[model samples]
Target: MLAVIRERYRAHGFDEIETPVMEEYSRLHAGIGGDNEKLAYNVLKRGLDADAIRGAAGDPAALTDLGLRYDLTVPLARFYATNRGQLPSVFRSIQIAPVWRAERPQKGRYRQFVQCDIDIIGDASARAEAELAVATLDTLDALGLEGGSIRINDRRVLDWMLDSFGFTSDERPGVLITIDKLDKLGPDGIVAELRERGATAGAVDAFAAFLRRPTTLEYNPYGERQIRKALPDGAPDDIVAHLVGIGAAVAASRGSATELEGDIPLVFDPFLVRGMGYYTGTIFELAHPSVDYSLGGGGRYDGMIGRFLGQDVPAVGFSIGFERIVDLVSERTDAAAPAVVLVHDRDVPEGELLALKAALVREGSRVRLEQRTKNLKALLERAASDGYTAFATVAQGTTPASLEVKPLA
Candidate 1:
């Protein structure tokens, strides 16, 4: 699967690059990750710094100078900033690596997991969003996951919705955070949380009405249509055009790949307030029909790179939830069996054994060589259980030509 991902990204002109696993503590705590900042595993100051921390200080900020990276996006931004002069004006990058978080571990959630991300920096056109969405969906289709849906919503749409409800600038952030929990809490739960967070009864009522409206459109199963009916009276024209353009691009791209056409649903979901604080424009999430949670998500962050370089760099990215996708794929696919297992007697000549192993490998066979055990039956039984389909035995003075392959029961 990783090979497939590498091929897909490289095929699209994204060069793979790796950034340090640990970044400066201040960078990790930059508030760009939203709630993820609170989950960072701060590295304690070491040596003399540790001694100073132990002696005095009301806050630990001085004691912590570094932290494990919470995500690949931030590190990539920093990398691009430090090496911008050497890199292409329009940089497309692929980063597949592990990130750490101190959050609670669950079935699909973990303290340490891999993230597969591809980002295009320097392209502000809606074409960047469309290409990213199409390429990622194609990768999923290549992996045999066809019954999934892509839900997209622009941050501007959320801004318009909040303004329509008369939410003040100071109040909008808190309200957006609550709305992000709509999937887990439901509409009633969101309203309750909002009221508890100081939203007025009228504001809560208005927000609830917006969610209940039949605005969310599923483009694949249901046909395509204008989303203007769902927007507020004065929703920005550019935002509406962006959504329509994305839908059309995805639809047009599907023409050449008929087998995968309509197999993956695409929808416009207004309530998808992806928890990241850096998302400035379009945001999207991928969900499988059989699963209740998102497989992964990403969006445009035109302002994020500028925080590092002091100049705006438009960017869009998509991440595959590595652990969750692997979990789902494992459940549906059978484990592959090894082609052959070579069982050699301890007294067998080392040179002959090496020759046999090398010969099998040269023929492109998956092979494992193990010293023959006194309990040969038990050894073969264990190998068979571990998905070895065939075995070859080496005798005390056997020549490579004398060995015969035996099929496992």
Candidate 2:
């Protein structure tokens, strides 16, 4: 799955780049990571004496110099800022690596997992967004994932919409938190949550009025009318138009037989407030019906780079939750380069086996040499499960030319 995603990203002109698994503790906690910051694993500072350790209670972060990265985007921001002069004005990078998060162990949640991410730096325009969405959809299709769709929204639009609703600046954050729960809590639950949180009475009442309207937000793939219906009158036209353009561009590029809608696979979700607080503009989540959770998500963070580089750079990224998607994607079945196993009797000389295996390896075959065991059937079944497509039996007198390879049943 990683290979397919990485190569698909590379094929789309995204250069594969690697960042250190550990970054400065301060960088990880710089508030951009959203809730992930609290989950980062801090590496204890070396050689802390009893007094130093005792003093650290006052400033726990001071006790750690570096920490495991919770996600790739924050590290990528630092990487771009450091390497900006040497990189292209519009840099496309692919990061597929493990990230650590200290989560309470549960099904589908782990302390460690892999993330497959592709980010575009330096292009703030919708083109960067379009490229990311298209590339991600293409990569999903390449992974044989069906019924994938992208849910998109803009933070700026959320702000504008909130302002229009009379939500004070102080009330917006808590309001967004409640809004993010719309799918889980429903319209009535959202209103209840806001009221429980003591949101300004007028704002909560106004929002509830909109939610209870007859033209409630319904799920659709994408369109101007669909978007307008989702929001009250006078939603920002520029942001609305930008989202419409993104949907059109991605739809025109997709050739899926399993599109979410009859036409496109992009959903303009006006309330998609992704968890990341750094997201300044467009935010999106990739969804598939097989799972209730999103497969992945990302958004534009035009201000993050400037915090480190002293100048802001336009950037956006999309990531695939590899641990979640791995189970969803079955082993690839491409027969172009099938794996072969050499089942050999103990009598076969190591030199002869090596010569045969080396020959097969040079000919572009993944050759695994397994000694014949008593449970031949079980061995063959295991090999089949491991993705070995064909096998050949070899013994003392066997030669490469004389080998008979048969497809595994």
Candidate 3:
């Protein structure tokens, strides 16, 4: 699977690079990563005076200057900024590596896990978004996953929705954080949580009603009408156009042989508020019917790099949740049996045994060499249990001659 991901990403002209796992603590807490900042594993300051460390023990910030990265995107942003002159004007990058988070571990959620990401920095066109969506869907299709869907929503559209619902600018972030949990907490649960967070009952009721509306897909005139009605009279035209353009692009790409199209639905989901604080434009998630959680997600973050470089650099990225995809794929695929196992008598020459192993490997077979034991039957039984399908036994009298081979029962 990793090989397939590398091939797909490289085929799209994305150069694979790696960044350090630990970043400066201040860089990790730049207010763009949302909840992930709180989950960073802070590294304690080294080579400091013992007295100073004891004095700053109450305030960890003074003692910590580094932290384990929570995602690949932020580190990429920093990398691009520092290496801008060395990279192409429009940089497409692939980073497949592990990130750390100080979070509770669950079935598919872990503190340490690999993230498969492909990001295009310095491209502001909606085409970037379209290409990313298509490439990601194609990759999933190549992996034999079906009946999945990509639920897309623009952050501007979400902002408009919040404004239409009378949520103040100050209330927006808190409200968005609550809305992000809608999948786990149903509509009623969301409203209850909102009210608990000091939102007015009227606002909560209105938001709840809006959430109850059925999900809208592209090219649905009625759905567009609903969106228009829900948005303010003067909602930004560019945001609306960008949203329409993405939907059209995705719909058109569905016809291509590379994409799964009808089998994997791509629809507009107005209520999706991805938890990331950096998302500035279109946001999306890939989900499969068989999986309860999202398979992966990403979006545009136009302003993030500007924080470091003092100039805006448009970026869009998509990351597949490596652990979740692996889990699903593992469940669907059959375990492969070993090609062959080599059994040699105790008196068999070591040189002959090595020669036999090399010959089998040259034949493109996976071969394992084991010394014969008094419990020969038990050894073979164990090898069979370990998934070896065939066995070859070396004759004691042969230096580099014939051997006996048998298939496991």
- The numbered model that scores best in lDDT is 2
Models ranked on TM-score? 2, 1, 3
Candidate 2: C-alpha lDDT: 0.88
Q: lDDT per residue, candidate 2, 1-409, as tens digits?
A: 7788988999998998899999998898888888889889999999999999998877868799899999998899999999989999999999999999999989789999999999999887777888899898889989899779889889998999889888999988889999999999999999999999998889888988988887535565577877888888988888888777777666556654333445787788888998887999999999998889999999999999999999888989999889888888877656878689999999899999999999888878888999999999999999999999999999897888998989998
How does model 3 fare in lDDT?
A: 0.81
TM per candidate: 0.90, 0.94, 0.86
- The numbered model that scores best in TM-score is 2
Q: Report backbone clashes per prediction.
A: 0, 0, 0
Off by over 4 Å in 2: 216-221, 252-262
Error of 2 at 408 (Å): 2.4
Total colliding residue pairs, candidate 3: 0
Per-residue lDDT value at 121 in model 3:
93
Model 1 global lDDT (CA atoms, 0 to 1) = 0.82
Q: RMSDs, each prediction?
A: 3.2, 2.7, 3.7
Consecutive 10-residue window with the lowest summed lDDT within model 2: 253-262
lDDT for position 281 in model 2: 92
Q: Which ten residues in a row have the lowest lDDT in candidate 1?
A: 217-226
